[model samples]
Target: MFPLERQQKIMDLLKLKKVLKISELTEELNISVDTLRRDLNTLTKQEKIEKIYGGVKLVESKFAESSMDERMVSHLEEKERIALKCTEFIQDGDCIYLDSGSTTYQIAKYIKHFKNLTVVTNSIPVVNELMNSSVELVIIGGKIRLNEQSVVAYDYIFNFDQLNILKAFLCASGITVEKGISDYNLEEAITRKKIIDMSKEIYVAADSTKFGKDVTVSIASLDKIDVLVTDANLNKNMIQKFRKTNTKLIIAEGP
Candidate 1:
């Protein structure tokens, strides 16, 4: 197979089942260990996969550690759908906290012209998105974490803890019943949990792919979420499981 195709296959396998050993790749992909090694090397260079002792693992770091540009490509159509779904929970004259994520940022796009709305966010890009709007904007001030492209240390914790929030949109690395809402960064998780705790209603903005994934830290339990807006591609059983919770699940693609 072509190199790009092979790399894509490797990523797919890793994403589907986390880490993959060399022998496993050989058995499944019908390729030699050497070819697999080359594939791993190539993907590693591309920052898609990280090479482990005897296998390869998908890159799990959301911020790539300490890089300044914490940019990523999300499932765009799904994010837009979720954004639309979010509007259902929002009423006029509501004060909301928007967490930093590609999906949450999508929500910002939909809220630009919204009246009687207040937005408090840590993302610089998010602030830029809503700055021109008539909606009241409150930019959380803190130590700017370039990697996540957010403010997490000071402004979000001390400054925001004083305010009463009506609603919050939380983005997660994984939204599992087992682990609750988890994120790659500790500070980010803390910020999200704090926001949820402060808000009268908490809504999780995530894509279906985020379900069942695992992260290092837990922000809050599934019971803490009042609403979840996600893509329609979530597994039916899993979606039903989430539906059984106190949280209301809203599919973005609609009926």
Candidate 2:
């Protein structure tokens, strides 16, 4: 099999078994030890798997709940590209909601040029990024999540209902055709649901790595999303699958 095919098979096996011994992988793929090692190295470099003493394991749940700092560093360039693309949907005087996530924080960074904009968010990092800017900021009130640097309060849904958001840029822990959009935290999921309900247009900001995975809670269906802004690294097969669902997929060019 080709290298990409072999790597994909390795990821498929890791998804099923979580962790696989190198010897077992060699047996399963019918490849030599050296070939298996190279495959493991490639997967590890891609951050799709973690190398252990004798084998490799899928970077799963723990990655979903990773700290904001951890996430900020993982896909910095992709997040920046997606953030820049998100700006295209924002008008000068638009009232928008920025969901709490590293990618959304990047959006906040890029929006500093918007002279007249009302920004609503629960993300502390986002607030910090836009605080010194000309944008009008409305912070959501809720119990603080220290690691994520965001807020989560179900009562805030009532506040969301009071406002009309022109557009909303949201992030997800994982997104799949079957499960739609999902995240690891229940409270954040509830908040995102409300944001979707209030917004006129919804744009999901996620990297290609987030595709084909499902996390703890569902936020919305694929149909609910107006656009999906992701990095250009997404495969053609995945893009075709997303197109079949009628979700407008925008692959942001990387810097």
Candidate 3:
């Protein structure tokens, strides 16, 4: 088999079995030990898998997420700075979509004063925060995912294509040059993909820590987003890497 084909086969097998010994992988693929090592190194560099002492495991399955309350406090200062920077993109009358996330939730506290602005979301926390705010609020009603505190429509009651979404501020579990954007939940990623397609512009609000990671469900690639707003704590190496991509980068500075 070709190198790319063999590598893909390795990933497929790992996804199914979760982890396997190096000897097991070599036997399954009918490849030499040196070739297997080369493939494993490539996957590791892509942040798709990790090498244990004698075995390898899929990275996506190992990534754990905390509850909404825990995440809110985990990156409090960085999230706040990102939230403040996102507000600059909002105009007086633009309609926007805020994807459910702790970082995106911080935006709710700052956007109350904009006139004729409409905020559409699936997040319960966002709705409650802007309940009495002057800006028009629209909720995407569906089955509630309590842990994330967000609603997801499995039946398409709300046609996002019909809505004139000027901008969409989204969050994701992981973002990478090769994988683009991804999430842990398949349902959530599906909903975000719909919003991304319908909106005029896409703005992904992720902290520096979220970079270089890849999750199970694919959202959109780097080219799909108009801008990526991240904190300045992101290293110069990563920033330089993104500079080579088509996506525009915005680094939020600390006050």
lDDT of each: 0.78, 0.86, 0.88
Candidate 2 clashes between residue pairs 3 or more apart in a chain or in different chains: none
C-alpha RMSD of candidate 1: 8.8
Q: Which 10-residue span in candidate 3 carries the lowest summed lDDT?
A: 60-69
Clashing residue pair totals per candidate (backbone < 3 A): 2, 0, 0
- Model 2 regions more than 4 Å off: 1-64, 156-158
What residue pairs are clashing in model 1?
A: 141-155, 142-155
TM-score for predicted model 1 compared with the true structure:
0.72
* N/CA/C clash count, model 3: 0
List TM-score per model, in order.
0.72, 0.76, 0.75
Q: Name the lDDT of candidate 3.
A: 0.88
What value of lDDT does candidate 2 attain over all alpha carbons? 0.86
**Worst-scoring 10-residue span by lDDT in model 2:** 60-69
Query: Model 1, 247: alpha-carbon shift in Å?
Result: 1.6
| Model 1 lDDT per residue over 1-255, tens place | 887888788788877777677888988888888888888888888898766556667775754331222223335577788888887778888898888887888888888667789888888778988888888888776778865678884653466667778989888878887667887788888778778877998999988978987777789988888887889899999988887777788887854
Determine which window of 10 residues in candidate 1 has minimal summed lDDT.
65-74
lDDT of 2 by residue, 156-183 (tens): 3446667879999999988888879999
Q: Which model, 2 or 3, shows the larger lDDT?
A: 3
